[model samples]
Structure formats: structure tokens, C-alpha cells
Target: MKKVLLVFCLIAISTLGYSQISGGIKGGVNFANVDADGDPDGKTGYHVGAFLTVGAAGIFIQPELLYSFKGAEDFDLTYIEVPILLKKNFAKVLNVHLGPQFGFLTKAEADFGGGSQDIKDELKGMDLSAVVGAGLNLPGGLSAGLRYVLGLSDIADNDALPETKNRTFQIYVGYKLFGN
Candidate 1:
């Protein structure tokens, strides 16, 4: 876990040297659910992260690191997620993004009237998903986007349990450290 974070930081630091490279902090609400019995029920959670974008000729590659809180009802799961997106800028105002996202489980717990109990042992360590979204580019590198994350792998660890997959809707606002 530490090594993964370190690598992300290293890439972030390296992006600072280029005029076309920008990185920033982002945080927003997440409507997360599991696809067990259809839409399932979503618990509103939050995600905070940092992202770096490298662009050339209106095309860009963006990498983001985020800590996201997911799950709902009786259980809550926390994850450290990495998303690498390919973006196409249009009219210098809107950008469409699509790519793969990887998630590492950091914590898992169940809440009852009594309190909370750790359930990490029963959970899987990794999650893979697909992300698709669009962002509105603004001055000063401040931007906003709405995206959906659809799980490509089942998160269930036991065969006895139902087939579970993640579904998340995210809306975020970001501001680059340096003006564009």
C-alpha cells in the first residue's frame, strides 16, 4: 500500500515540470451501491483525491488517486482508487473522459445498533472498474465533472454469498495548483 502511494506521489511531482501538465485536489459526493438485487440502495459518501493531467494537441492523459468511502445500509467499505483516463478536449471548454479504474480495499466494516465491526477478512483486496464522464474546463484549471464507475469484477469473496458488483456515480470539482 505504501509503495503504491509513493509511486503516485512520484508521478505527481514529475508532472510539475511541464507547462501543459497540471495537477490538483478533488473532492465530491459518491452515490455508491452494489448490484446484488438490481440498483441496490446507495449510501451517499465522499471521495477526496489528487489528479495530474498531461496534455498535448487537445488530447490528454489523466491519472488520479482517491480515497473513497462506499457501500451502504449495514456495511461501509473504504478504498484507495487509481483512475487513468484518456480525455479529448473540444472547443476548449468540454472534455470527455473514459478509462479504467483500480481500487484497493483499505477498510471494511459493518454497523449495527451496537457499533461497528471489522469485516475486512471477508472482503476482496482489489476492484477493477470502468469510468466514463465529461468535464467542463474553466479558467485557472478549475474544473468539474460527472462520472460513473461500473465494476467489471465481482467483489464477493465467498461463493455462498450473492454475486456482488459495485456501481458508483461521482460528481467532482477540481482546481489545478497553477493557472492554465
Candidate 2:
């Protein structure tokens, strides 16, 4: 058992060292949807975040901290979200990603025709989602990625109320801090 543990530890360390573990900041726009019976209203919510990327031969792990706003038209729901993803690289410039995401609600607002109102008490404060996407590395250390985030947890607290989940499409531009 000791021999096996030692071997595993060494392999883990070597893998980390082999992978390009780079940290940087990222931010982007979220095209968001509140999943209703039909196509939910589309609104542009924004997000800003930082990410840690660990990339190796053909795989990478990216974990991000983001402030995200997502909701349908006339509503503004904001939260802080954490997403961890596993990525598979197909080429030096292209990769695919998928993972789990969770969020804590910070604020909620609704636009009445004449004014806006807060409705934080009526909704759930926590959100959970699954994310999948792909990315392309561009010239000058710039990278672009698109992700689809599907909400798994209901946003409504009352079971009798209509349950709505969120679907968000995010496009991000990232810059690598370390060069290859």
C-alpha cells in the first residue's frame, strides 16, 4: 500500500508540473433565458470572473469565480457563481469543456412599467447548473469560448408555483498570463 501511494503521489505531482497551470482574469456577456414553456425572453446579462487553468497534453481543469446576472425580460437576478470544468483539447487551438456550476443569489429585481421593485423573498437564493462548451485559442494570447449553462435546481421555493430554470449562453475572451 505504501509503495502504491508513493507512486500515485509522484504521478500526481508530475502531472501538475507538466500541465501549464496559469491563472488569469476573465469577463464576458451572458445571453440568458428563464426556461418557460416556450422560448423564454432573451436578455443580456454580464459576468466578470477570474479563472485558474491547468492544461496538459490534451486535458485541462478550469475553475472560475464569477458575478453573474441572469433572468428574463423585465427581471434582473444577480448572483455569484462558481464553476469547475474539465476540458479536452483537440488541437493546440481548440478545446471542449463541461462541468458543474453553483451560485448564491445576491439580489433580485423586477421592472414594473413605471418603476422597479425588489422581490428577493419570493425566489430561491441558491442555483445549481451544468455547463458545457468549447473554446478556440487565438493569436496574441487571446482565447474565446462559448458555454451553455443549464440550470438543474429550481429557482422557485414553493412547490406549487411554476418552476423555472435558467439557460445561459456565455461568450468569453481570456488572456493567458504565461506564454508557451
Candidate 3:
């Protein structure tokens, strides 16, 4: 994990030169849920973040830092997630993104006033996922997109409970402040 993160960082930093750099903020709605033994229901949440887009032409690099809310009806989780995506531009108005994401769990608790509990131990410290999305690349960097995040790691600590993973569908709008 460390090596992968380091390599990604190096690549992102190296690509900043001789490329277009655009920074922007985005906010979106999350249709999130967990696939686990309990069959917990899906939940609606929100995520807001900022991103730096590097590169130009047919290929681009977009690295984002987002505050994400996720999980199922029984529990809610908050995470600080970083997604580093490689994008390919098609024509002038279409773009597709594929990437890996790293997430750190910041908050976890039962919902519906189930009361507070130290449930961090029951969850994974770090979450890993793969993201795939498509966007409409409009002029002036204004854009709207949809993404699907598939969790690659199991979060449940107990062996009795079925393996749990995250499944999220996100809709967001973005605008570029500068650069292409």
C-alpha cells in the first residue's frame, strides 16, 4: 500500500510540469450502501471536495481530496478519501475516468439514536476502492458526472458476519478555476 501510494504521488507531481493545471471544488449526492451479512439498507449522504486536474490533450490526471459520507442504515461512516484518476478525453465533450482510491475512516456510529459506541475497532482503519466514472466535459471547466466506487477491502472484523464492502454511486458537478 505504501509503495503504491508513493508511486502515485510521484507520478502526479511529475505530471504537473508542462501540463495544464486546474483546481476546482465539487459537491455531490451519494447513494451509498454496504454489502454485508446483515443486509443493511442503503443510505443517502453527501460529499464535497476539491480537485487538481493536470495534463491536457487526450489524457489527464485528476487528484481529489473529498470528505465522504457512506454506509448503510444501521451505521453511518465518515471518511476522508483521496482518489487519483487517469482520464481520457473523447471528442470535446466526453471524458472517462478510472482510478484507485484511499480512504481513512474518521467517524463511525449507529444511526437513529442507537447511542454512541466505540465502533472503530469493528471497522477497517483504511479503505481501498476502485472508481470508474464518466463526465460531460463542457467549456470553462464546468462539468457534471457520475461515478461508481467499488470497495476492494473487507471492513468487518468478525468472521461470523458476512464479508462487507462498499458500493457507492455518486453524482456531482465541477468547475475549473484555472488551467484547462
- The candidate scoring highest on TM-score is 2
My TM-score estimates for the predictions, one after another, are 0.85, 0.89, 0.86
Which ranges of candidate 3 are over 4 A from the true structure? 1-18
Candidate 3, residue 87: the lDDT equals 90
Q: Write candidate 1's Cα lDDT for 1-180 as tens digits.
A: 999999999987776564377788999999998887555567899999999888767888899999999986778989999999999999999999999999999998988678999988877899999999999998877899899999998888877667888889999999888535
Q: In candidate 1, which residue pairs clash?
A: none
Local lDDT at 180 for model 3: 67
Q: Give the TM-score of candidate 2.
A: 0.89
For model 2, the stretches where C-alpha displacement exceeds 4 angstroms are 1-4, 37-40
| Residue-level error in angstroms, candidate 3, position 149 | 0.0
TM-score of 3: 0.86
Question: For candidate 3, lDDT tens digit of each residue in 43-120?
Answer: 999999999887767788899999999989878889999999999889979999999999999988874576766677
Span of ten consecutive residues with least summed lDDT in model 3: 111-120
What's the best-to-worst order under TM-score? 2, 3, 1
Clashing pairs in 3: none
Clashing pairs in 2: none
